[model samples]
Target: MTEHPSLNKKQKQLEPFIRDTFNQEMSSNEGIKIADDENSLKAGDRGPTLIEDFFAREKLAHFDRERIPERVVHARGYGAHGEFELYKSLSEVTMADFLQDPAKKTPLFVRFSQVIGSRGCNETVRDVRGFSIKFYTDEGNFDLVAINIPVFFIQDAIKFPDLIHSVKSEPDNEYPQGQTAHDTFWDFMGSNPETTHMALWIMSDRAIPKSFRTMEGFGVHTFRFVNKEGISHFVKFHVKPLLGVHTLIWDEAQKLGEDADFHRRDLWTNIEMGNYPEYEFAVQIIREDQEFIFDFDILDPTKLWPEEIVPLQKIGKITLNRNVDNAFSETEQSALHPGNIVRGIDFSNDPLLQGRLFSYSDTQKARVGVNYQQIPINRPVCPVFNNQRDGASRYVIDRGKVSYHNNILADNTPSEVPVKDGGFVTYPSTVQGMKERKTAPLFKDHYSQARMFWNSMSAVEREHIIGAFGFELGSCLSSAVRQQMVNRLARVSRELAEPVAKKVGVTVPEVEESTVTRSTPAVSLMNTIFVADTLKIGVFLADGFPGHEVESILKQWKDAKLHPVIVSNNLGEVSGTGGVKLKVEQSFLTGSPLKYDGVYLVGGTGADDYFHNQARKFIGVVYTHFKPIGARKECISLLEDMDINGKPGVVIEEDAQFGRKFTEVMAKQRFWERPSYLYYV
Candidate 1:
């Protein structure tokens, strides 16, 4: 692993806790070896069982209580230990110690998760992805709780539980585990207009990211960056992945059921292979005075500030270089809360965020024990001093006569410090209003920004959105719910609703065109970064292939940092015409097109009809999915007979410059403009 000079201390702390129970004799909790663990001491092997069997009771007792309550939402997740290094100091915006110095690297642990599912849910689902990070700063633990999308389903925190309940599986059935494309979710959206923008986002390609490493993260709620002078700016945080944003098409997403661990496995395998995931830390800063001037409410969690209006200012980067040692202890027990803010940071009146500050801590307390922070994974790197003592799972012992604060016995030790002494100080703000149940006027107009999002999408993205809407609505048994959603969508754009209405058998209501025709270019997936690095390419070949021709292309792929897996009709060595043999790592039955970013068709010489038939299926799926395909001269015959020659992303290596040209094409990631792109829907 590439170790950052500043992150070594975190590794040192966790090293002592690493357990190596390998090759040890299996025993009960008390270290007693059981003579027979199998058969569970049941009925004494077909005779009457005895209550005196203490070993069996102990094993069964532990197994029955092994599970704790999974998170109410975002239960399915994967995590990695990493460090964040600030390249640009934000002293002008915040006095937050971690953001003030460019020379220091703050160790952090990040958990990427899918919302609205249990811990065992599939990874590829049409739902929001939670992107939470805990920075073990010397000031304490600072958690930035975020999501993949910039907005949310509700404006107020009071409605948060209702929103989650509506999207989750029906309480009576509990059938669907990992998806939001169901009756209750659409019904909830149709009834709640505040969810319009986030509903559109969930149906977009952002929901089904190709990998956790390729998706963007957003803080979702507007926060404050307080400077030493006590001046604060309204800020929205963003995490831009270096690998670029990408997603699987709906068909490929469905195929992920066979390997639901694709997203999680992709992260672990790449990290183990030394392909560390990196993301740029960016933010949109609005002066406190400018917050009230935005067309959309800055504090509304359901709305996003247009990036074109407030450009993203790049500040730093985070590199995830280490995978978690244990899922339950490190990834599960660690609690991330929005309330875990450091000094230079503070909260806004964003209702959703305000509620999350309370909910996260409460949930962690219930999920883990009362002293959850005392857990090894959740403990801070810095020395901690507090008056709090003894609770369940307490790891600290308070010495001598004082466990309470403001006591003469301990000389008022562990007392709070003044704002000047590195203690947390909230920014002073004037407040003069009676508490009431009401939303701001700006939060009421939701359709305008939703319309702007619709206009931002490219033609291909628009088609995908329409297909997503149709599929989701079609799954509903209630025609009224489908029609309601179609009508709600019409408010965003008639063009968007028309196609979806036709497929869902709902009437297209006559709605006026949206006046907000302008689009924010930054939100579109088409505008993301794309490179050839770390993309997986499947190379199909058989015996008696052209070794030199294949080797030349393989060299190009290695130079481009693309991983190529050799595929054939069966395993074992395959002889080439040049007397060189290549090891086959995968076969036709073992390989699936969804597992690769692209495919290379090469050297089909001496292949039987069955072999050729398998090659045809490979090419067809790769082509239909719009991935890049390259075929050498011998393999060109295989692609030619299928009549897929000269397609948008297909490259035939006949000319001398074929290898170079094909490498350049694969760098584009996918061929979205191919004529077959229209055929997928």
Candidate 2:
């Protein structure tokens, strides 16, 4: 295959991005083992297997122990390290060291994961993403374990296991590797209607984020903040991406799994290009007395306090400036527990959160041994001295002979400090729950917010959600499960369930309006920010192209901070006009546009018809999916002759300013303004 002139130059730029992603995965991936090249263990020229062969025994032992318990849920995950910088101090509301001091930057580890997929599952699967962040603060480690969506599957922790079990691959066959439309999942949703609000979100495009960097994150449960004077206020954490909440079309998401690791590559590449992903850490602070003002219970994990009710207060920025040194040591070994709070931060009455406080510590013991905090990755930057002594796998070297408390000879070494001396003091809050097990009555109604979410989406978003539900339900073999799920959705909205019911070959059930009437219009992604500062452009070209013209345009894009990738039929240099040339970054046989944010057509006059065919095929894929497409004058004929000249996102070169105009279009991503009926063309 002939190579593209620009592809080589692009490859040089993308090299670090691709390499770092592999390094991270290889370090953390326990299953991958390099095969030994020597002969197999045997006795007398392979007459019998040798029990004395240590290598074979080691290999077999490792293989047999390969399966550590997968996460009960969210088994598949990708992680990165970053710093969170505060914009201003909130000293009046909290005395937490990280929040009060603007000069202090807190180091944090964040793991983005898929809820339903196994460790080896695809990146673009239709499921909620776990956006859990562990902040290594000066006071202590505080974890804001959250998800991409603002709500959850169930209101209480008691139902968490049930929700996870039902959504998981059936116990018998372990079917549906990275999906949620199976019989058990739908049956659970049908039976437990509290999941209605989250079901609306799960069925929407938000479930299939375009990239981990572009999605929004939320602390699904309410928490508390205490001041030095012991003044407490109810609060919820929000992580709004600077790039904004965006998603891929269902078709593109499905196609991305051909490589399964598409998102991992995209993230690593963008960060390596010095376009580190960033998000604004925002919060919704509600005074304790005012918590009862909302129609829905603020403590319910299954519901979100709509932005309209409590506007997000932007306080700081979280930039993932550095990739991990080692995946296993830094990214994987890092532990996050909600109970790891500073003096000012405290928990709320949210039942699920209360349960998580206990669950995380218990799980980490199994995942990283008993003394998990002693691990370098999980250790705090500040000094950690304590009276508590050794446990399993304790790596810290504590000196002195006396380890117990109140020792006269030791003079009470590592004694507890006073609260005034920067010591942690748990926030004082009253607890008046009965010994009996029960749920809040306010948590009973779930369909109102679900209906609001459905009603809030634009026509396109609504269609995507319906399509997502249909696809998931269609995958289930049980017709009864499919029918029951659709029947339940009808209560949220007839319009939402009608399309899904019809597509799944089931009759729609009669449903009454939900007694719950409150609505949060801002829950939809249509209302979120979507920018294109670092979106990648895959430039497809070959030998004998007008190198000078392409180079000049690429320079303009670089100045605009838009990354461009040069791809060809082969990987190598391609001769361009005026003795100039461009390097081929990836070959058509090796890469796909699914790895890129958009496509650029720079097929030059020097390229042969064969090269044109390959470029045409790539262009066809991008066009069919409403992705941004740009063409220079040399290939402008292809756009015009093919009758795609007036398409919504098609950028035909009309002026020398073609590069600038194309950059603007890329910033907007798809001309989602274009009707989907013309998508096939």
Candidate 3:
């Protein structure tokens, strides 16, 4: 295998463990070659196999135990190898080795996942996305387990199990494999008022992201970043995608549900095509003394420090440049823990975060075995030294008599180092409070932020949220649950609740409206960055089309980093005028308009009615989903027939600047200003 050009310490460490089976004979677990393996040591030619078949037994035994336990949450995930490069030294705020050196590149692995799903669940479900990264720093491994949403359902981790149980398929029938549009979920949301903030976000477009590369990641907890002099600051980590935060419309997302691996396939294909996903690593830091100045508690996991109040400071960039070699070995076997912190980073008093520090490690041990860290994918690149002993599947062999601390044997080897000598030291935070189960008083104001989130949404986003709420509530069989949820929404906004109540067949209650009218533009997806790079455009064609113009346009699109895939009636070469022939990458049956970011129509002179009908279908779907649509002058009749001509985001090739205008329109992604009725149709 060829080495990756930007290989770091972790990649180098993984080199020795990588095995190649090519040109090698299959052998038993003990490296013993066996002949007549297919016969399985039968008594006769057609007799039953005997117990003497050790090779078959070994193979069967391994096969029987091949599957380990999946995660309770975030089971359906995809990961890639990446490297994080610091833009500037952060030694003043954090003494972490990875953040202190601008020249050094820290190797890392990022796993993007859905929160509520089994391993076989669809990837495009409307749910929170887990964006966890494990950085293999020189000091040790630091795992920044994050979520696409900044806030969580509950402020305390004690409600985590209950939250998950409520959203999971109902106990009696296990129906609704990967959706929250059920009675139990709404019932829980209505009962737990603290979930209001996160519920609003879930109902918004953020839940159904366009791709993992376009979603933003938040650490979801306020952590302490202690500098070299032990000065501590409360910090929240953020991962801003270079492609910008984008989401799929509810209609598009529903169509994508047919493809279980949509997001996974997108990530893998983009990486393989050298369109590596990139993100900016940023942080919102607040001085420890200023923690109480904010109206909301900094330690509350259910609230986010509005970016307008605390601006993001971009410190580094992470580029996922390499795809995993093996999905099971590298992606599945990998484990991340919030407790996996380096020297300078320390935990906060956030109850939710504190519980996760224990829960993640415990769950990983139960799921992947006691010595899960010994797995090559989870191992630290730096040398590990300790008195820790073996457990299940122990990879290390301790050849010493002493395996305990404070021992004279072996001259007390592997001694602990002081804080000054690069040892981890927890900040000496002053704590003087009685043990209590109650959270801070500020956690009670859940609807304030939820209302703020509602107010922050654009008109189109608000419309989508209303539709989402209606759909989710309408799916529930219980009228009580639907009514209760609408009443809960009433506290957030009347505009949001009234329509949703009407949709779910619930009577709207006259309640005191929320006075919190402040909106954070940063929270809205409408204000996000947009770029044309790596945006997939499906180029529809048949035969005897304007190939010269199409070829030139494709060249310009490629120059702008737009991926244009040829789609036709069949997979093969499609000949055009002027002796131009192009390879059809996908057939009409294989490709759908829902899968592409945009569509370009180039009608063929030899096209039949069936081909025209298929093109019209594509145009209709693209137009309804509010996606960009481009067409040559010849295909204007098809667009007109579909009643989508002269619509927003519809660019026709009429002038020399058609390609530039189309690319610009494609970068804008969705044209929300289009008529609202056209979206759902």
Off by over 4 Å in 3: 1-5, 679-681
Candidate 1: segments with Cα more than 4 A from true spot: 1-7, 23-28, 31-56, 676-681
TM-score of 3: 0.98
Per-model TM values vs. the true structure: 0.95, 0.90, 0.98
Best by lDDT: 3
- The Cα error of candidate 2 at residue 316, in Å, is 0.6
lDDT per residue for candidate 3 within 1-681, as digits (tens), equals 778776778888788888889998878979897775666888898899899889889999999999988899899899999999999999999999999989999999999988888999998888999999999999999999999999999977889999999998888999787789999999999999999999999999899999998999999999989999999999999999999999998887888978989999999999999999999999999998898998889999989999999999999999998888888999999999999999999999999998898899999989998989989999999989898887888998988788888878778778888889998898999999888777678989878889889989988889999999989999999999999998899999999999999999998799877889888999999899999999989998889988798999999999999999999999999999999999999998999898888999987887888788888898888888888999989888878888888989998899989989999999999887777786652
Candidate 3 local accuracy as lDDT?
0.91
Instruction: Single out the weakest 10-residue window by summed lDDT for candidate 1.
Output: 1-10
The residue-by-residue lDDT of candidate 1 on 1-681, one tens digit each, is: 344455455676777777778987777788888677775555656886667778888877888988889888999999999988998889999988889899988888999999988898889878889899988887888898889999999998889888888889977888577787778888999999999998889899899899999999999999999999899998999999999998888878887788879898999999999899999989999998886787888889888888889999889999999999899889988788889888888999888888888898999989998899888777888888887778788877878878787789888988888888888888786767789888889989879889999999999899889988988998888999999999899989989989999989999788765689789989899999988889888888888788887887788888778888899889888777788788888898888888888888775566787777887887788888899998876776677788888878898877868767877787788898776444455
What value of lDDT does candidate 2 attain over all alpha carbons?
0.80
Residue 676's lDDT in candidate 2:
69
Overall lDDT per candidate, in order of appearance? 0.86, 0.80, 0.91
How many clashing residue pairs appear in each of the predictions shown? 0, 9, 0
Report lDDT (Cα) of residue 478, candidate 1: 91
Give stretches of model 2 more than 4 Å off: 1-67, 515-519, 677-681
lDDT of 2 at 103: 86
Clashes of 2: 9
